[model samples]
Target chain A: MLNPIEWSSGPDGEIPFGTPFPFSVPFALASPESPGLYLEGVRRIKERGGRLVSLWGSWTSGADPAVLAAFSDAEGLLLYRFRLSADDRSFPSIAFLFPLANRLERAVRDLYGWDPAGLSDQRPWLDHGLWDGPPMVPQDASFQRSPEGADSPQEEYPFVRVEGEGVHEIPVGPIHAGIIEPGHFRFQVVGEKLLRMEERFGFAHKGVRTLFRNRSVSDAARLAGRVSGDSAVAFQTAFSDAVEVATGSPPPRRALWIRSILLERERIANHLGDLGALGNDAGFGFGSVQFGRLKEEFLRTNARIFGHRYLMDTVVPGGVAGDLGRQELALLREECARTKSDVLELKTIYDEHGGLQDRFSGTGWLDPMLAGRWGLGGVAGRASGQMYDLRHSHPVPPYDQVHVPVSISRLGDVSARVQVRFQEVRHSLSFLDSVLEALPEGPFFIQPEETFSPFEGVGWVEGWRGEVLCWVRLGSGGTVLDAHCHDPSWLLWPALEQTVPGNLVADFPLINKSFNLSYSGHDL
Target chain B: MHKILLKIFRTGTLTEPLPEPGPPVKPCPLVRGSLAVRHVDAGSCNACELELHAFTQAFYAPESIGIRFVASPRHADVLLVTGPVTLAMKDALRAAHEAMPDPRYVIALGDCACNGGIFRGSYAVSGGVPEVIPVDGQIPGCPPEPKRILAYLEQLVSAENKD
Candidate 1:
């Protein structure tokens, strides 16, 4: 079985390749619907304790859309590919077996119009009637992308309704009050208490998958980084690693070490910002100021070291775009030391503040059993006892070399999520402290030769939110044929609905911020 | 409370001066030195929004310079929009802009908002914010830094306020 307890015994370190094993035989189900290889493949993986990391669909010029599901277990990643005939536009939906696949399957339908057979929720996901046809298909291929897509009225979303005494609905925005990304939230509430909450996204979809199609490796990496923007380094790292894998060009050991520095810095910056936001959401304005100042300082230091504050496009194919020399490393260490104590002090304030604690504790409680069943990945997952971190379990290079600690909790409340952030920041900073001492000496970036033959690659990185997975196929002369960058938010957003009900309607923002699910990441 | 105050004292004030304004905007004395801005996210990657949040911190105290981010478009002098205007958000952006009171200015805050930056040809996006609604000015960057964003708003305020 594929338990997460053992190390990956695969040859090329975790990522499995060759013609996927699912296609070895027809593997039909006895039921009349049969559901075929797709259902059976997911069922087997589920039986072996595999978590649905990501599910995406792609199509070639002549062929119809083919769906692929990625499952993560002790063996790193196991991929299931089911190529459908041009006639049958639907495939067996695995949402019933693995609940996390629900939104993903819906999204696949929205993008490619491929039906997830027997999916309960058939509502439009990313297609807010923006485009007439599947945007994933090229203009010359399956269907034409109508220029007058705006002429079509958006389909009315079918939000689940709840009725009772004093039960009313509150619909909050695609254009939210705050300067955050757009997403709609429908709440079924009685007075101040929420009975049910359903999230609606796709207000931020920019067709990044289609944009990624014809671009070169460099441009594709940049586009991938923008898929969420905040997780630029994570996306860039994942994409670059994917391309590296496809081309069979792993960068030098020093490059991998430097990549780790950028990754940790990205994590710390985001954590500092989110921690502050969480405190503010919990009614602590002081938390915003203190942590905001610290985060600003952190970003300024990033701009000094790497040209961009968010370190966008820093990690490219083969290696990173830049390196940290002795001087840069020294500056980073000094900043690290300064912020480390400040974060500690701020954490103390957040911990000791009775008001903050009262608001955080028991707010947005996600049951541990529900969490495990859904296979939540990332920080929120860790808080809810999912207890999986790619850095520790499936280490790639520098992570493999160094000891990466995972912070876990079974509380599964907003406070536990916040607590996980604090501990994680501490862990990341310590990782930086240890690694910055002696960055291996070598060339930072390696230029890879272009390949005309088609090759496939997959990359999984422990992003700030959780595991960000990228799968890519390179066409002639280093061009991207098809690519899908999967965000950890895909799993967490559905989990957000579970956290909100039974909590105060007003605490939604605080709870939402605690999880900090990415609307852009999810929508894209 | 004592520790909080002490910490505040230790940190002190880190606010920087808003830059002297220069622009081609029509000068008006109405609501001089004070502007209520409503920010709308059409379809940004949230990088623009991250920088927008910098206004809340000590170093970039936006209220000190008389710029407040209002929640409603009804109580605003300007509408700040970010990202490429995705097809789903076109109507919502229009509705928000229409909701704003007269003599309102709509400024595209990033490259994507200005000319659809990198998300231009995607089937999901209609175009930049300008394509969806008329824009008075643009602050273009993948994401303009906090200082530049502050500077642009200052220009608008300066133009609005008579000497």
Candidate 2:
């Protein structure tokens, strides 16, 4: 069950840390727990086998800057708010306990200069020394980067060196050969075999924290949707859920169901694309063409029904942007059924093909132990024997009524990921069918209050990749004070780094495509 | 292989003719019938990249129209840049342009590439493609659809000489 957020109170009845602050989603609060207490809280959560979902710092106006960590459990999403004094330079590091926290901790350091105490890996993660310093405090509108700030990271970055006979380094991209987001990969290899695949991302950091500040709810939602364009619906849903929680405005049941429909459609479309891409990466261009055509047709249908290709901005703050008529719902159901059977045929081809099977069966294997240790979940996690699914584990709102089947595989390779995607597409299709069977009727959107008192809330949804969280703190007059949108890619990127070694270097693309982790989402 | 061939044969080509450019579309000065383009994602959110990939998929089959997305900038005649130019990517964008051979044209894709788009005033982004490298033309939209993108590219496809 969800552990209640521990919030203490001062003598004057101000919420100082036992006073429970209510959150609109699943419910939790922010109390600046001391370092010792914070450590104790995190230890308890870890003991309970809670997975670290997201970790970010928030500095709202008129309040002490605080660092927060989100942990997922049976109860829902539990939060830990650790208070940081102005003089404090570091906080207790959970990276030692949770390996996935390592990169996020480094990101916090780059953005807020708050280093995780007692952590050994001090290499900068998100910051490339492109800016003057950590962007913790917002700069003036006219702030400028120093002339020398543009020094090439290729010249300065210390990619962990490997010294041995026949060990050579192949540095690839911040700009890749194909049309994908930018991120550098430093592969230490012996001939065609990979020794280690170290990555340096953050090439797509468009300053989410800087952009989220002082923006209206609608503007913030739009920005969140753009965080990772592929998962636009998920990001906006989480963003909207966060604001609705903070502002105490909940959408009608009808909107919630519609939001889920959009989410499932988005899932189906993405998985369809990935199915083809995974095939293409393995030199099976035929699979790419077949799936790509299917996905394009699906997206075209979405444009006709939802008025947007990626379903961007469709899930707004209070409710959906627009309600679907009976005709649109019928159209969606027809498309879902068609795509489901289309994928089943491809699945047969994948299963029966010897060459594709040979290349995919055991390539880029990730063991179950590593997946669990790093708290990997979603498609990749399911492929690696981690069976946790947010829709099943912790059902939020309409999900409680809609049962979502978790498709899992233990093989933990490129093929396993492919299998998981295919199954998930089927699962989403059934879930979508069930959702559309009976349409609820009510006001789709309820306008939020024009102004709001300073309040912090969090919302998360199980996106196609994995679960994504958006933490928001509203300032006076309904403007955003601080916000952080954490993508599941943050956790998977490191998990992916572990999957590549000992595999042939050529299989890297196949492995990477199978997971298809988001470079832009993680960088943001 | 026969089953695969049968499957491929059953699913006929879905490729369509490129949409004709509107009147405001200008002809590029470069004399070319085909384009060998290189893509550099300066700092895109990946939406534009997604559409670009869609443009190359079976539904579009851009190669049938003589458009090839080359691997290296050195082999490119046109540079397709996406997203707002981030500070980290600015040098790389400029470097990619410098690497391209003479008479190389730059086409900024998406609203972000055109003028920084949604992430305009952020500290990390240094505006759009024009800020880092000279841009010959731009395709606009949050992410211009594949049809719209092909129409924009079609403007540069001259009927004169073959590469």
Candidate 3:
């Protein structure tokens, strides 16, 4: 029912809008009219029931500054591209329409030196003043060491103040007590009740985007896998998908099935760890020990079946690197069955446990409307009644063969998040079994051509956390011109900010653990 | 309750035998005691943290070998550092290292901390731990497994004892 129409161009140049494919549609706009067209395009997508996935900017040496935005719609994905001339470096902000665009715009400004003119929170997002200038400027090599004395006199971050009677501010670390990534959180509190929570990330930003430039497609896949360690499989697959699409090479069917298997395994392993951590934060040590043991078992299985415990480097551009034999398949089948039953029992125990219920239910509530407005996805979104899953909604290759039942709840609290994870673990187990059962017969990998024509490709995968969208533009001979890998954490991080208010200070950890947005993923 | 207790009993203890210590390197009393580690993630993909978390889990219980993670660097005898040191986290890493008491050993876990791994020369990163703080030992791998980490700790402790 939603009609797709092309945008008109001005005197500058006509924007090229590619034909919509089954998976993704690619379009481009010129600098002169991009501000109006970009806003109109975003509005049209939302009108057509699409949500923004990610928005990023890239700076290449020869080409003009480029901005790419991805949105998920009922049909598939809508990718909007805008090219800005050297003379004109500003674009009207879309943050007013989409609140999630605030951080993305800030990152674009800090990294590529592009100005999003109308952005609300123009305060520096990732630029902690640790460096001298915009790193991604084409003239300056983005990876050089800072000037002498640049390290001294760290810049003070201006956190928004909420002043009132009995109001106090609590600042938590860039270095936490647990073995986790570094991220600072500033909480405005009146007694135990949280008035507001502001998050400052980028302690883990290692200039991953800068490293992606000029690398070969194969080499860049490895960097993509490490974008976020937990979502390594998803990130690698998405990167490979983009490269493959750009090069016009579809991987072998068997390779697709194997990639799905690895993705499901990664999902199960992370869910087990999170469920255990959530229980532990709620004062249930038994749950932690038991679930921790189960996760260890799963990781061991990954090592035995695939080469790496984290399944890193198993998915390459052409296809996957590893294959499962009969013995491995049998072992996995038995393990999957066992894990499912055990997890079911654990879920039952959690539901019956009164103390955990008291801690989980109604804590860190995220309203469904807020979740939709923010375009939240993955487990967090599903818990909040957003039934959008890339696996189910946008079924690519192997996922089309196997049905992925979306597990959604309306509670939008810690309890709902836990329940959604529980349901997903079970669903992933079943999905794995089906894929392994229908494991096709073919080569695990196909060699890609040595050189590829200049083209752009978009890859989207539903990682355990949520949808991870990757965009790659390959020049002649497979040289990467620009690559933007956007993690789902970008959208969910702000949602965590919203959920923390009205909850007690003591419940912050539990609420935080429930969302568990990847600081490294977001920071990157 | 009984079922849960039975599940624990059936699982049994997951303690693994520690590797044989190398000959003592010097006459240091600190080597005789257990090693307490304070972990700092300068900038990593968190794959190393996953392996480290697994090291504390039941399977490769590092505690059985006198290696346990502490909350504070002051209580720590060893600083277990992971990831390529990002510019934002460099100061924090230095502060954590300075907070540690003397007789401290810095162990760079995973390839990132050893020599920046894949993220070397990144715009926001200053390579590895040694770029900011001195490292006493290095464990290599995209993420070295739990057993590998424990073995490295054993060797460090043994060599210190010899001294």
Candidate 4:
């Protein structure tokens, strides 16, 4: 094992060190030297062939706000934290170095009021200039806001303008035509060709981060599960993992196996839905109806087995809330086999279909280099040849036992994304088979200790969308001091902006569905 | 083409008869015809949306029962709102509600929209759809299943038929 203290300390001084959490390397650098050390650490990690997993900020009472950035290295996951003091709340922007840090820094600015000194875009993220004050800031007797009076006029957002002949701007909603979440997309176009695209999200920001504060560990896990509905299992697992690590107790073997099953089911459900939607967007109604029927079957099975279609609240802090019997396990296995055969048949049909190929072949190409620079992951990143899947790269208990295949393609178009999803679905099916066959016999859950030391824990899970990282700090008696749930959409959304530039405005839905980044996830 | 045609023939229609409207759905004379719904996601986790999408699938085909999702509120008779209204989305939700023609029915879907569910009283959230706009009915669950949504709509239709 790498020496935590030695790697955490720097030239400036010895930084504070926390006990290393499972699958996480934690370090805290002083505010003065944080900018340089953070940049240097990022460079070293990149040079050593590591990918930046997540970047977020956490603030506790009576301390400086700490910006935590997690990276996946060959050894495992490494979390580097930088403390920014209240007096001097500015740090050198790493967005200048890493494009992924652009939105993260803006988020930190919007939530905690910590300014990233050299950030190129200073526009408020997750904040539309409507709130009374920075909501995430700790409220004391001294902290007071002006009383509410007449509602202020809606603030005009400054979308970047592109100037040229025949260039016109088209603004789409925070309220769309579909039954999806709300987000605004601005497109700069000349006739049919698009010049640039800008996205403004956060319409779904429900103060999720602040809601986690001061809650009991179990209550917090419930909130985390809803961070993004589709990724509920992944988010809950990460939160539970963090709590388990903090309490210094690993969940039982049976619980870990159940968690893996839940994660795989979540992945399959999302991929099935996305595939159908992508087909529908490409004008293939047959594929949509077929795949949609398959997804409903899967969801119905989940409801029958797990008691909820989305499997919300199934994962608690120590372990899962429910258990599976022999009958259910056998049914799941049979269902998996049936779905695999059907999907295989559909795959041949999709590949041979001329119209789908025509629309999907050359549309929405994201270069591998750009994908790497922006730190995109999950299916979208894999399609662009960024070979970083956490299931294989940083395997935890159950995954460590079973093998996970990383899917990749060089095309980076809608077709490539679709292909990756199909391959991943096959892989997940085989994985489920092995996992269920080797299902361990043990207690499903254990009650964690009520009292916890003042320590921090980081939970990292490979969500269907991408890597999800949850950081938590527990005070005495296990009260949540601070918590941050970082979603992969932060990185993937920017990739959408890049891929949509040259494609027609009509093809935007197809490409966007191909990525399917979560607005709720990013907005939170 | 033969395989496609064969598959289509093999997959026969899967629509079911609409359930009976419950007590809450009172008949409104103005809405005694096919209903057009405009879904506005005020601030949901998208679970409700997924369930809502299921309403259009083979099993629970709402289209066969005179309910269709419209593209614009101007063409819609009912506004199906989800989530606890977020601060950034409050204005847009109101605008959508305003755009609907007179006698517009508002149905709040999911626990978040009905009462704010778990996200209630947060700084960025206003807690429930009624906080932002008037709601005529509510279908409550973390996300009410497709069957529940269909039942609620059937209630509205039956209520109109009664009128």
By lDDT, is 1 or 3 better?
A: 3
Q: Give stretches of model 2 more than 4 Å off.
A: A1-5, A8-27, A30-32, A138-155, B24-31, B160-163
RMSD after CA superposition, every candidate? 4.8, 3.3, 3.6, 3.2
Query: Candidate 1: global Cα-lDDT?
Result: 0.81
lDDT score for residue A6 of model 1: 24
- Interface RMSD, per-candidate values to 1 decimal: 0.8, 0.9, 1.0, 0.8
For each candidate, report what fraction of the true interface contacts it reproduces. 0.86, 0.81, 0.81, 0.84
lDDT of 3 by residue, A70-93 (tens): 776676666666666556676668
Off by over 4 Å in 4: A1-34, A141-154
Candidate 2 accuracy as TM-score: 0.94
Candidate 3 chain A: worst-modelled 10 consecutive residues by lDDT: A144-153
State the local distance difference test value for candidate 2: 0.82
Q: What lDDT tens digits, residue by residue, belong to model 1 across residues A1-524?
A: 44222222222212223231221111111111235645775687788777888989987553345687788767567766666555667768888998878888878877766778777876767777767666665566655332322224456788999988889999999998878889899999999999999988899998888888879999999998898888999999888877877776767778888888999999999999999899888778888999999999989998888999999988899888887778998999988898899988888778888998999999999989988887787999999987799888867667776777898888999999999999999989888988898678889888866766776677788999999988888877999888999999998888899888899988999999988878888888
Residue A357 miss distance in model 3 (angstroms)? 1.7
Model 2 interface CAPRI class: high
lDDT to native, each model: 0.81, 0.82, 0.82, 0.82
* DockQ scores of all models, one per candidate: 0.84, 0.82, 0.79, 0.85
Q: Compute the lDDT of residue B121 as modeled in candidate 2.
A: 93
C-alpha displacement of B119 in model 2, angstroms? 0.3
TM-score of chain A of 1: 0.92
